[model samples]
Target: MDTSALNEALAFKSYDKIADICDNLMLQVASEGVAFQDEWPYAVHLLGHIYINDINSARFLWKKIPVAVKEGQPELQAVWEIGQRVWMKDYGGVHEAIREFSWSAQTQGIVAAFSELYTKRMFELLVSAYSTISIQDTAVFLGMTEEDAANYAVQRGWTVDSESQTMTVRKHKVATEQKLDPSKLQRLTEYVFQLEH
Candidate 1:
């Protein structure tokens, strides 16, 4: 299988494009009645879905993979383990799976990118959901050490009480400005005038 396109996509960190590329490749190969010469593409394609947090799609992809191919590629299996953890909404397990894998050079970049993106998303969610939360829980949620989590909170303008071991989330107020379109306002005014008449 020619992986140049996929490799190029990975080089650009265009993770969202990977699924489409792999799907097209698989379809073309299937139409030609040929088996994949390599299985790594399947793994990368699944990781692409996972990176996008499309757990449903990742689960579907895993279900469609041939058992032989899945078994033959430990890296693929490792990716699936992360997908499974994600499916179960197991944040800590997701980090554990990532840490346990000895990913090949081909897959390492995407894996690292996924880890960074997942941590960022978790941080945003925690900030919105919790006003004050335990440092240990924050560590687990963000896949960081307690000290690191505390430090990260502090950097984000959150306050950490050393005695209580809890961090207070700093919520920034968003300013909303509603702008009305002139055409729409005029149409609405005309309609109201007609109704009054």
Candidate 2:
């Protein structure tokens, strides 16, 4: 496996190419079997790295790796842990886990830029998941003051209760028009709302 080449691509953040490589590897696995002992787990981990900010993709990739391989590589397991932490809305835990996870010389190059990128993404995820979060937690996570957090939250269409110093995310309502089923309706109105097929 040309880990150097893969690492280089990841270091440069060429996600499309990384995704292409992952697709090709998975195709090869399907056609034959594990071409190399290490390739399967490595490809899955690379995908996890590509989707460091995306927990669902990270989890899907984690499940794609065989259980035995997951045991052999704790770091790969750590990657999944990062994703899980994000999913649980533990932004601080995500950052802490990211920092605690070991980065090999091979991995360091690829994952170096992920710290800040991942941290910001975790913050965004937390804001989306929690209607209210402690102002201190927001301040610590964002490295900003409560007032700044309030400003940022409001800009993102969220509300903050000043007295309580809690942030609240405003949910966007999905707009849908009520359309009577033509088959169910006994008679069609003169003006019927017809969806574009």
lDDT of 1 by residue, 127-196 (tens): 8899999999999998889999999889999999999999899987888999999999999999999999
* Model 2, span 11-128: residue lDDT tens: 6776435645655656766677546656554634553445545556666667777788788987776766666776786666766766787776645644555655664565666656
Question: How does model 2 fare in lDDT?
Answer: 0.63
lDDT of 1: 0.88
Distance (Å) between predicted and true CA of 191, model 2?
Answer: 34
Query: TM-scores for all candidates?
Result: 0.87, 0.56
Model 2 regions lying over 4 Å from their true place: 1-8, 15-17, 41-52, 122-135, 143-197
The ten-residue window of minimal lDDT in model 1 covers 33-42
Angstrom error of the Cα, residue 136, model 1: value is 0.4
